[model samples]
Target: MAKTKEAAMRTKNLRGIVRLSALAGLAVGGLALAQEAPDRGIVHVGGDLYRAHNNAHNTVFLVTSEGIIVSDPINRDFAEWLQGELASMYDVPVRVVAYSHHHWDHASGGEVFADTAEVIGHETMPGALALPSGDTPLSDAAAALDANGNGQIEQSEASGNLAGQFALIDADGNGMLTGAEIARGPVSDVYPPSTVYSDTRTVTLGGKSVELIHVAAAHSPDMTVLRFPDEDAAFFVDIISLKRLPFMDFPGLEDVDSLIGTIQAVEAIDFSIGVGGHGDIGTKQDVADHRGYIEALRDAVAAGIADGQSLEELQASITMDEYSDWGSFNWLPNNIAGMYRILGGGN
Candidate 1:
């Protein structure tokens, strides 16, 4: 499909440049908002790390004597805006563009800093970006849009980033969307990480350090939980949005047990501040709370399944009212649907 070709070309081009730069003397490297809020600004996370936000979505960056390290471009415009901000605010160019995952909402617009930064991610990112076969998992929200239950998402069914992008994302112009198309969403282009790593890897510049931990996650297998030791802060994208209820069905979610494991992996990291891809800044306890929320949800859904309750029945039976104070509390229904699907509820 056209999406596959375009993605391959971008990855290939980046690899070529990175290789050439390495031989030439070693080279360089490299938003979304929640609530549809347009608020934008930068605040210190601690030490050399700072978070720049555009409404509900935010990205963390590290600045050092050598250069700057950034995560997620959010979108083309957001990237462009951030690039200009970096230029005016810092002497060094962006040297690294680290992705928390391959999700278009968090990882797109990387081209904005491609000239001066190295794109990096978990090794599995390249495979996830490939135009997927029909087997790609869908978030409950996205699946609901497949009104007819057909594998393909039609233009009329589209909303949010996929709306009006039917032509571009369709790739083959077949008036249908594959998992790849819907996943790519509204992004014009996404550059796969040229410098990929597995398990754990650390990127150092000047005198600062940033660590990336890859783990199995329901959101995306490519999830990279970032830890900035210097700042005592960690950046975990959609895998953990502290203080906020899980997004509609958390598209791409698959296994409950594995997702819990993913959270445990994050807990092992030693960071006081937890900077989620969305929501406000949080604390280490927030990470615990984050994990506890999932654990609670998993237990509820498992019991419902054991009782042979329907998805709707479980939704009503488990209000998750204890979390009513959290943002997007009403998404409990969709959240239940996802937990149900993964728990063998056959949602």
Candidate 2:
């Protein structure tokens, strides 16, 4: 009877926590909708180059001569909105769509551009695609997300949602999740990149030199940063988002120190404007802020582990109060959880 009562209490507490989380999400969502659009996302920063923000998860880039080369599309709705924006802003068609990694927020809406432009990413992009098409174990795990045994998983279903449906699968088919798989599930829905590069690739489009730089894992193993040397602008995908909390979605956090070091390593490259996978256009200060934020969270999680705090406790205790004024507080919880796992050596 005591055991039964204890279990019942625990269940009740869990329910309360879920309810609180839902309410908090609603509050944040409301604020996001109410807030005015940032000037950075909509305004043109330089010659024929424009950056636009869709919610808190994607950044769309428009280049006059090259058409459009977006970092991540985030979702169908946002992708549609972006398409319309591009149509209005420029007369040319979108030529290339790029994914920083395989995460849905960064890659899902690639299908929208598939019929138009050539999609490109790291060489692992096709492997990412294979995972979601149910071609691998990770894709199988994601396909198994239909917990209700429903024949079809709709967007509205809990386990059927976009994020739920694309759960990472074991990439190697070795019955074990690799670091890359943990950080970025196989790409789904989006068309696999026609061009995938393991190292660096530089191409000239509309007279602008676009350099694709593959950095060591900070956000995802397949992550790559795009630089427009002539434009004096570089787009770093999920390695960092604007004032938004950093997401540790991939298993790459195990190499957080190296990730930070890699970012600093690129600092010597002269660039005027820096664009992220999420949030608005920024300066070098934004990059420093992200580095500092990740370092602080790493330290906090490490301290929690030393203090004998459970993962659950550590996650609940780590707040984004310091970054509350940042554009996307809604993403903090997930970011915190990712950091906790990385620091606790779970990844």
- Best model number under TM-score: 1
Taking the tens digit of each residue's C-alpha lDDT, what string does model 1 give over 173-289? 556777766765533356667789999999999988899888776678788988998788999888778899878886666776677787777888889999989977999788778
The parts of candidate 1 lying over 4 Å away from their true place are: 1-37, 132-163, 167-188
lDDT string, candidate 2, 147-226, tens digits: 55543333233232332332222233332333345334434335467678888887655766677787776556777777
Q: Over the full model, what C-alpha lDDT does candidate 2 score relative to the true structure?
A: 0.62
lDDT, candidate 1, at 114: 79
Specify the highest-lDDT model's number.
Answer: 1
Backbone clashes, candidate 2: 5
Report the lDDT of model 1 for residue 14.
40
